[model samples]
Target: MSVTRRVQNTVRALLGLTLAAVPGTAAAAAAPEADDSPTSASAGLRDPARKEIAMRLVSSAENSSLEWRKQYRYIEDIGDGRGYTAGIIGFCSGTGDMLELVEHYSSAKPGNVLEKYLPALRKVNGSDSHRGLGSAFVRDWEKAADDRDFREAQDHERDRVYFDPAVRRAQQDGLGALGQFVYYDAMVMHGAGGPDGFDAIRRAALEKAASPARGGDQGTYLNAFLDVRRKTMKREAAHEDTSRIDTAQRDFVRAGNFDLRTPLTWKVYGDGYRVD
Candidate 1:
């Protein structure tokens, strides 16, 4: 079967297991732990500690800063064929997601600065064109970043588009915060749920190792996933630096940190970072 078909089958199987009444099934075995640490009281990486670590990782890759909050106003056309890579999660204007974020922001705060560019945003969706956008759009996006509502809208859209689905898939696969963060990071860099995206990387990893949901070792499976992610990164010039996987996530897996606990230390792009 095709990779996309396999991913769909995997998700369907997982969802079925989650709804199944069978004893000792994958769903029953993959339940998330209760909140004992500073993290949230649910499954996946939604907890505060895990979320903070994730933000730092993304920031290290995108902005070289641990203060991910500072990237709210970050906007630029990096000539990557994806127009206007901006915001905390690097929402691309060409992907229609950025337009969706602006829509949400406008809904929350009417007559926002970006509201004027709705026509241009629609035109530029799925293409590398800044035809109707220029310095003013950049300035307004930066200005919008100053608003709490705008920031919240960005956060909501990031979660809705990337973070939540990645975490859900990891949970279904019986993976922990590390694995969930792996999925999230992949989704952030390469859009989620597509054939050449996160699901393909995951399916490739599954071919090499069994998932925790399939009664495999979590760390081993994650290492396999990172290996595939590294290969995928090397295929593109912009993502050629595989240190984020080799030095960062791989370090966590080497240390047997499947749960992605705190006091974490790693390097991305040759810069040292620590999170406690």
Candidate 2:
């Protein structure tokens, strides 16, 4: 395990936190005791309406479309070296999540179209190599997208691998809907364990500001996190466009929209988007 991984494990163990991953991101140790306060701030991303908003917000950046459901069949390599970025959350073929999604799909419905590609998916698990899977695999993936089971599998894997952990950690940190969505977006874009992954970024942000659970200002802490995320995104060519933070999430933070109220407007890659 990396130094960041070790520290994260110790932190989670101490806090009794079950988060994003066995290979997931890390969270700050300070968890606010559950607050049932009937306030917008207490409403989290798990709330159905809020969750839908979160989905649209992320889709604006990830798929360049607010119609996130349309992206279940989306697949292609955007040259990030992560290989086929697909589905609603941009699950990369090079990354483990895509493989895991296929595995989950295969398990849930055996002999699924995607099940046959498990070996190829496993082979390219960590690095970008399309040795065994080429156009045929891509076509099959699009075909599989038409299956309701495949769609559910994508949703399930997304929640298990990214959404659930992110929302849980953000809620624990006393962040409202916006913060929870911010964490979820970061977790989706950056995986859990690497140096530039979500866990490391979270750890870096915590170094600069205490989470709201620790009594720090919510906006201040979120700014710290976004600043760190922006820097991390800038360091990579594929993620060089930081508008997801500068124009979207940062705008929300600057406007004091911690509850992430609707009629929201933002841009990603200079394209305008709105959720009202």
Candidate 3:
């Protein structure tokens, strides 16, 4: 295999994620200059926030559906074990594409820089200038395939090299776009996501998944998450018990492809998407 492919394979093995699944930041426009780091402040400080509410509302909805009180971590485990990994927008991987967007304005650029990819490395998720990058990058995933242990060798390989300083800009913009994208993606399922043009995107995704464009097991996990969430809503409402819905949801999930629920996020949701 080629070197980049080899690196990708290594990344998959070490991080237990599939690049076919984790391409990051789907179809974003080109990035501007990076934000201000202590090392490169003033030059890269052009930064901003996104339009994503953390999963607190979703969790609240889930909680009300069940009428039971459980910790977010436990509920996520309940969700993940059942073949879906839900999380807030920060570390959602979809938003991680903002790593390419170093500055705030789309047109901003810095003085002549030295290297081709050096700009990408200037700002990362947890940097001083990174507003929501930390949550987008760091998460209490509950486990690796259910083990939440960050001490494993795979975790080290993942946090160190997988999310390496590949770009120099702040990823907030990319992250913001990603969060909105997913929100829009989910909104389509609920019958509304942002303005109006997004409806076409929903149709294209459905059509593509039904055609030859079906990727490495396309739409299974996300579909499964939607399935469980829907059922969880109904079940809890009928029985008036939150934990009961959580249990039923997990049962349904375990029956599906367990890997669909893998939380490392190797696939880029927009990978190979040809829809306009």
Q: List the candidates' TM-scores in order.
A: 0.84, 0.84, 0.19
Mind giving the per-residue lDDT tens digits that candidate 2 earns over 109-153?
999988989999999988889878899999999999999999999
What is the Cα-based lDDT of residue 160 in candidate 3?
A: 34
Clashes of each: 2, 1, 29
Stretches of candidate 2 exceeding 4 Å from the true structure: 1-41
For all candidates in order, the CA lDDT equals 0.74, 0.76, 0.25
Lowest lDDT block of 10, candidate 3: 1-10
| Residue 238 CA displacement from its true place in model 1, Å | 0.5
For model 1, the local distance difference test gives 0.74
Give candidate 1's error at residue 232 in angstroms: 1.3
Model 1 RMSD in angstroms: 12.0
Ranking of predictions according to TM-score: 2, 1, 3
Candidate 3: C-alpha lDDT: 0.25
Cα lDDT of model 1 by residue, 1-276, tens digit: 000111111111111321211222111112233437544425458876668778776676666656678778878887778888888888888987899999888888889889989999999998889999988899999998998999999899988998899999999999888889888888888776566588899999999999999999998899888888888877877787776787778877777767776556666555565554
Better-scoring candidate (TM-score), 2 or 3: 2
